[model samples]
Target: MKSNIKYKKTKLSTTTKIALYKTMLKPRLIEEKMLILLRQGKISKWFSGIGQEAISVGVTMAMQAEEYILPMHRNLGVFTTREIPLYRLFSQWQGKANGFTKGRDRSFHFGTQEFNIVGMISHLGPQFGVADGIALASKLKNKNQVTAVFTGEGGTSEGDIHEALNVASVWQLPVLFCIENNGYGLSTPTKEQYNCENLADRALGYGMESHIIDGNNILEVYTKISEITESIRKKPRPVLIEFKTFRMRGHEEASGTKYVPQDLMDQWAEKDPIENYRLHLLTEGVLTEKEDAIFKAEIKAEIDTHLDKTNAEEVIVSTESNELNDVYKDFEYQNIEESSNTNELRLIDAIHEGLKQSMEKHDDLVIMGQDIAEYGGVFKITDGFVEAFGKDRVRNTPICESAIIETAMGLSIAGIKSIVELQFSDFVTSGFNPVVNYLAKSHYRWNQNADVVLRMPCGAGVAAGPFHSQTNEAWFTKTPGLKVVYPAFPKDAKGLLATAINDPNPVLFFEHKALYRSIRQEVPTDYFTIPFGKAATLKQGTDITIIAYGQAVHWALNTLEKHKDISADVIDLRSLQPLDTETIYASTKKTGRVIILQEDSLFGGIASDISALIMENCFESLDAPVKRVASLETPIPFINHLEDQYLARDKFEDELLALLAY
Candidate 1:
């Protein structure tokens, strides 16, 4: 460990030095009390940062209040340095109503915009990508703010950390990546985790400036961080700082420290950051023993007051009415007049029109995806977007789905609405962690709306096979906060996209590859939006009802037109989540028979849920058993002949005839 042996009097003022001392001391005292609570069985878990106070406090003290800080669970000094209320911290651990998450999340897993601190998720690596996004937001808005994110040496091994560093470097965003290299990742030593000698060497791979320093030296940590932050403010850059420290305790209170060698723990105890810094101040005459005693006494009294107050508070009880509240933003739909003048547009062109319209309306809106900037996307959906919106608003991301999704969450949390396009819908599975765990639950957990629109080009009709083709609407529809929208025609595509971009919740917008260029319609030139959960009745009849979305909707229309005798009501459910149950029941009651169709597989598909809903709500009105037509339960084959056989379109005619006969 390299140490700055001498601390200059001019480098840090007396006030700032004392403030850093107090900042480091608060977390040490707070965690000491928390460990006592853990032993008494009052607290469930305790993650101590006893030996890492210098790194967390030093890095955080350099950041401005407007800049963001995403902290790991063990970085208690970060909260203390940022001046977060001690009572609120106590309330959060006790699950009281006054907590950051209103008793929704336990411990340090809550973020508040007021403080510019994003709470850590249990999965720590994803927050690295999120910090990049928050930095991106600050850059796009010309805020000139720097974001600081902390993780341990264990986190550097995660793919998300690599993706985030690559993105921040490529984009030249202002982000400080701090690695608390605590010598162990829950008993796994540094040698077992990486092949390199120093973890900071990994930053060179991403074209970032790297530094290695003695983390136990408080003055050294603060001096280096302040200098890095000052340089980053002038010219945005991504920097990596590796603090070679040691974890003096177990991973958590429940996880015993037996795996750690007793000799190593004894060695680190002699170099305790707080005690070392305290002795240095005393030796240098910067502080007297009496002043040190006063500072310690003040911190202890403050913690005791908040602890008592938080313990006396009542726990929050969730009611049925508010339990589902904030899952989706429910605002009154405003009906806009459609233009008499119209333009003939293909489905792809209509989607482009929606994007242009949205960007023109909202200055804070941004579009991010792989190959979207210069290449204009694989399908040309975002062609000329960079020229129109500039590269700042229109971004080209690396082929990292997880980082792309997690970055969008960070931007959304920072109050910037974003639209992200997955080149292929099948790749959504790669980005499923943030979408399901973070994005889907943001609103419910903390009333945090990641107003992000995810555009997925889906379905199998283009002969693209399994890797590029998939309709995964069923996956998001089951998620509470996600709104799933699948449009069939060009006009519907344009209108629904406009609505989705303006929505205050996460929306999964599915665009069928087959329909992109094949489908054309006369769409209104003026801006228009179709309300979610309202089914459009295409062709009405009393004999049978065909309910479908995306490419299946067109298949139903084609089948009905071919057989004029089989008069049927074709209902297009534009949005799957807000199911349009009223229109569905009305159409099924009039027709007395129904057939639900989908391009996805049969079992556990969206059609299954619709069938169950029909049975529960309108079972008595059905004259015959409801039928479902969907693709075979297997991966889509590459051969065109096999693909054609696997699709539901070929089988739709027979299923419709069977339903008519019934």
Candidate 2:
């Protein structure tokens, strides 16, 4: 069924058509280059935009540079409108350093702030949230720059899409969400995806003004986008534009696509943008066949040169070294390497002090989440924060984690470094989709890291069983871009929290309620930040090494005292992502055995990661196979005896003994 997109034809001049088609040469050339690279065994697979170039050029030409754009994998064409050079783009596809994103991400995931392009991410529905955020930030900054997000029609059903639209509508952000209905999300057609008559009407549920347009026509796309963008600029409100286009090629050009009907393909192919636009331009006398041939030859020559340059460039090098350097341009960690002079403050006091110092030091900092304003938050982590920073800065949000994270992403894009409290780590799952798909992948995708800090309480000992007692680090341990820092001591807590707020990437600052007021280490007299991924050896020994993080660090500290004969080294793997294989190996080589400790389920925990790394790098140095100590597979029960029987210091000691005995 054809969409009632309210399309009107305009007689574009020959010069206008020629100029637009010439501008599209780069993306079309890129599509052709994908075929050359694929045959040479350079690129494994690709998604060609051979027939979909006009929609991107039209939308891009309609927007200003300062306006935010969240692109999909298929919108690599949109990226050319950004400043990503063709050689660098080919290098990315060939997996090289000079590539657009420094090779931290795949070909489809490169963008830069130089283009006002918020990164291109691949989490089916989460880009909508980021688009909403850019819009929110525009409103907050009082800037006229609207945010444009490009996605597929298949992404409409995901909860994140609705969450983002609803938030954007409620906040009335200046965002134009463009859904490119390319008919197939991999194999499934639009017919199989949703039951709605038109995707735009779905926006009405969120109170957003939505319209559909002929995506294949450059004039139609540009005209409607211009009108909607103007509306966003004039009134600064959210609008949705559903582009009714067709995917001429398969997703990634690898699978024997069992989806997308042959008849639909043939029909859409008949309306192919590249071919149709060529005919239209020829009919309007935009160019003679001679001129068209020359233009095509020029595009091919340019693409060939780019491919040659890419293969000569460095390929698949680690950007891990580049991680720390490019992330923070001006934000510096407050270095405090002095002796501890302050008394051990309670966990609550420590949290308050750390946050106060952070917000004071950085004016860009903002705090938001449920009950985090004048109410001082559920755990009172934000006590007296609003009085210090005002309600606008220290925000209290509705009981919605997804909305809170989406808003934080928006604020971060607008120059606010947000510290969002998740109330309890258990509730983080509500926002977990964005964390892994958006927050974690944003930097790798766009090359511009949108920095947001998350502070949440996590652990299993405070009787908040099942729902609240989960050790949530495992959820994001394997995620690429995010940094998870778990501080065990009062000293480490303040330092790590300060550092987390300062870092440019999303940092999960996990705090323990059990240690909030009970256990205390000598904290610093003043504010300071401990660098991320730096492991600290609590106690040194020769028989076995115990690797622990967060609350388990204290447990390991206690277990070491109980087993002096064992003489084990206690190493804290504080930062999770850049797992310190160096420290783990050094300790393992000396001790001859390794044991990873955690308060969560041992079946799938951080301990498994430690085991894998040691086996990969320091396998020959081991005296025995590395063992793991963690909670049982079942959820934390309300009964103290049942919980204690499964997880704690004794369980850790038993695991260590088992490894030693082995």
| Tens-place lDDT digits, model 1, residues 504-598 | 88899999999999999999998888888898999888898899999999899888779888778889999898899999999888888999999
Query: What does candidate 2's lDDT look like per residue over 1-662, in tens digits?
Result: 23222334566565666767776776877777687778778886687776677778888878897777778777766788665678877777766777666655676776566667765556666677767666766766678887888878888878878877877777687888888888777888777899888999898787789888888877788777887898778898889888888877778777545566788777887777666766766665666789888998987887788777877775465656666555433355657674557876877677788999989988757787888888998888788888888876787776668767866776776677888898998899999877877777665555556588888798877776788888888887777777788877777788888888878778888888888877766677787778877898888878888888877888888776787788778898778865787888888888888888888888767788789878998888987988887878788876777767767656777777788898
- Point out the worst 10-residue segment of candidate 1 by lDDT: 1-10
Error of 1 at 68 (Å): 0.6
Query: Which predicted model would earn the best lDDT?
Result: 1
Query: Which segments of candidate 2 are over 4 A away from where they belong?
Result: 1-18, 24-26, 29-43, 101-105, 255-263, 274-301, 304-334, 337-344, 396-416, 433-447, 474-481, 520-525, 531-597, 603-629, 649-662
Report the Cα lDDT for candidate 2.
0.77
| TM-score of candidate 2 to 2 decimals | 0.81
- lDDT of the candidates, in the order given: 0.87, 0.77
Best by TM-score: 1
